[model samples]
Target: MTTATETLLPGTDIVLEQLPKVSLHDHLDGGLRPQTIIDLAAGIGLELPASTAEELGAWFAEKSNSGSLVEYLKTFDITTAVMQTAEGLRRVAHEFVLDLAADGVIWGEIRWAPEQHQQKGLSLDEAVEAVQAGLDDGVAEARADGRTIRVGQLISAMRHADRGLEIAELAVRHRHAGVVGFDIAGAEAGFPAGRMRDAFDHLAQSFFPATVHAGEADGLDSIRGALLDGRALRLGHGVRLAEDIEISTENGTSYARLGELAEWIKDRRICLETSPSSNLQTGAIAQWGDEMVDHPLDLFYQLGFLVTVNTDNRLMSGTTLSRELALVSDAFGYDLDDVLTLQLNAASAAFLSVDDRETLTDAIIAGFEPFLDAEDAR
Candidate 1:
């Protein structure tokens, strides 16, 4: 990104990337390294929009920042083009984890739709296996490097397609193999979770967790469908759920009146995977404003909703989890305590056993302590 990700903060001396973090909504396909894309494209004889790695990175950033979901999704064509083979998928998954470790992420969930990579005619299960193999390699490599990190797969089903049931079954079939949960992605406007009732029903019967991408291209109705119909434990970029909240001033104090949908989501402690830069780029919060401050992250947190910040598309949005947290912290004038709260929310929502979640929470609390000490000394 020509804008330079280092400019994410103005005067903060501490590099937040080194702080322990948890990533809930990262995508394996959306985060391929620019060099990997170029090399893979060459191997597959696919002509890229930009021949060089630097140029290709710029192309993705520009297209994603265009504020049109269709145009933004076009950038993925280049990434997925080179990721159809087993070798390609494995390498991408391995590197995706390494990048997260370098960014100081202790835990993460990498979501990708296996249905999209079938252009090479690989079966749905094989694709998931390939990615899992890569994730194992990534974990071993990180431990070897003395940087401990863990990641799991969240197999996604394309909402516009009819294979959600199959994909959901694949996720459940591999729950012990590597798959952590199920998600429905792509074109959220016309395709509501209600349309995938059969898939959700089957997943519910299997007792598998689901996260739905709602309130992104659509509004509160879609969010309602995700929670009610899909039984989502987490909302993917559910920023537009803010549409159901009414903020008014009473005696110079702000009070909120939440719609039934928002109230249910908040009362249930449903986690909102809010990605600031991506939300702005995808026009998820366009009705609010053109900047990151316009994001509903602070509002959701203040209203007691389980809000977790994320880097939805690291390559496209040119952001990391730390960058997203810093963006919101600046917008809301938050302290280190606020940052820890966000990470705690993510740790709790992670598709892990209770023991694992407690371990992760402990890690985050320990990691944030030194930063708090630094602030105190100053």
Candidate 2:
């Protein structure tokens, strides 16, 4: 597998890892370094399926490719198990930021369920604080190494569980700390965002931001629930929103007709946090096809919907933000301009103040300007 630093844009001298990027939908429990998992599991007296980092990484990748979201989610059992304690969470959180910085991600949101990590006796607040401490350490370390990166926590409530209200409060409580937003994940089919109406209402009243995992495991109704019930600012893995678009070709020309929901999402520029590899693995895009090229990301982008590329789980997908961008570029014949547009979309959709978002946008544009100019001169 190619590391982010080694992956280059197709037919270009530009390295993908050198490009400034933003990640809005990454999962914390899903991004542990394989070696860290082995060490943490050993300290916790837990037995792992694979003894070596390479083998363990392979195990996650193999299991995640099961083509079922439920089955794909099973791999998190091992990862979350090792992260039950404050120490484990801290180490994993620290390493996660460093890895993101290494991959040239300037800003990212790491989402995870605190309720799941309470198995080791850490309170939800304690767990959030531990992760924040580690994030702070990672930021300091990266700065010491001359790399600039910023990250925030997106507290998640398991959709299958009933802690939505509790988790929403937890996120709001930590808003001034490291928590930036709220989310609901796990088993998205039957459990619509409407189930967590009270949580969303609380967040709305508190003026907190949220991003709902929708249009991946379910259809348009799920997306509707996300917008109307969850009041999400962004759609996690909203790739399946393509279903609402009717496509037809006429005399060698193609046209796309948007449904009401699609038109609203498009007109409003609600960010679609699309993960190409993870979407394929979870069979989220199976209805369309099983290949990266078949992903409706291009279609959505062509239609002017706010689309941002992400790696839902770095370890499970054995991918980086850079790798995801490279794959999409290869699939859709995208250039630096497309890459810049995607980063800008993510920057605009981030749960930050308008001023902060503008700063991030300026940084991304500046990073891409040199290469874009070079491309223009070519």
Candidate 3:
């Protein structure tokens, strides 16, 4: 049962929170409950900008809304600070899954850089293990509550750091455990994925899947490196790829011409893990406009790009997958079919095996059937 606070699909009585959703770009550290942060901070002797949960949540939201990716990223210092110990990582990971489940996410990939959580002597492997344990606990708890949710770790390496190869190996070593894929994130403008060629090469040789953070803080060149060097299966916040598209108005009709880069991404069906609220907060969509309507997500969808909506940082953005979908629906006038298409796109792009992907796709279709039937009846 969804609460009054649950987001409803625009122009429909259906609760968006009850829809089957898939999250591909959510951050474990960025999804913690504000009270959990306070509790963990007290244990670790860390000072936070706000004391109460409400204030802390608002502080994160305000700090993240600075409209600069750099400024938006500064809020992570507070989040990652409290996530040093195994206990802290576990609790945060556990709660992260529960939150995703509560938001009606049936499958989610929680991405985070393990190297950043070693301030308290936890090894990289230990950090991954701790998070996996927490995810497992959360899954069990969710199942007990009759919520079916599955989660995987997308272990990330900081782009500004030189530990890409090391992190890649760690991710591969734990593939059979809870880790699903690998990624390179953080400060995308200067540090291109080419810098992590060795890591990508290793992942490719090992036949592991990867998604590179590109086209968010950078442009086409960065996205090119992600595909060419990193061999990314998906592009994280690939919103800027829209820059390669030229829209011109001739007569009363407007047409879009795709550049070679945009053409290739579109032709190949590479997934775009777009975070609507976080994209706005980070100024990722400022080139088009500052409003949700200005988001190229609708343009991308109209052009048949494999786009999936996500909540990059729920705490900072004060959003959920359901909320992200509802925002896009409201902005683009997307109905139930559009929403289902987005979920299907995400299900297909998930780092699961072909059979697993089919299973997920079936589950998503099944979940949306009743709603679609109800819409038809109406």
Which 10 residues in a row give candidate 3 its minimum summed lDDT? 1-10
User: How would you encode candidate 3's per-residue C-alpha lDDT over 1-378 as one tens digit per residue?
Assistant: 457568899998899888898999998878989999999989878888889999999999999999899898888998999999999999999999899988899999999999999998999999999999999999999999999999999999999999999999999999999999999988899999999999999999999999999999888999999999999889999999999999999998999999999999999999999999999999999989999999999999999999999999999999888889989999999999999999999999999999999999999999999999999998
Mind sharing the TM-score for model 2? 0.98
The pairs that clash in candidate 1 are none
Question: Candidates' lDDT values, in order?
Answer: 0.90, 0.94, 0.94
lDDT of 3 at 237: 93
**TM-score, cand. 1:** 0.96
Off by more than 4 A, model 1: 1-11
Better of 1 and 3 by TM-score: 3
lDDT agreement of model 1 with the native: 0.90
Ordered list by lDDT, greatest first:
2, 3, 1
Estimate, for each residue in 126-220, the C-alpha lDDT of model 2 and write its tens digit.
Answer: 99999999999999999899998999999999999989999999999999999999999999999999999999999999999999999999999
TM-score, candidate 3, is 0.99
Error of 2 at 88 (Å): 0.5
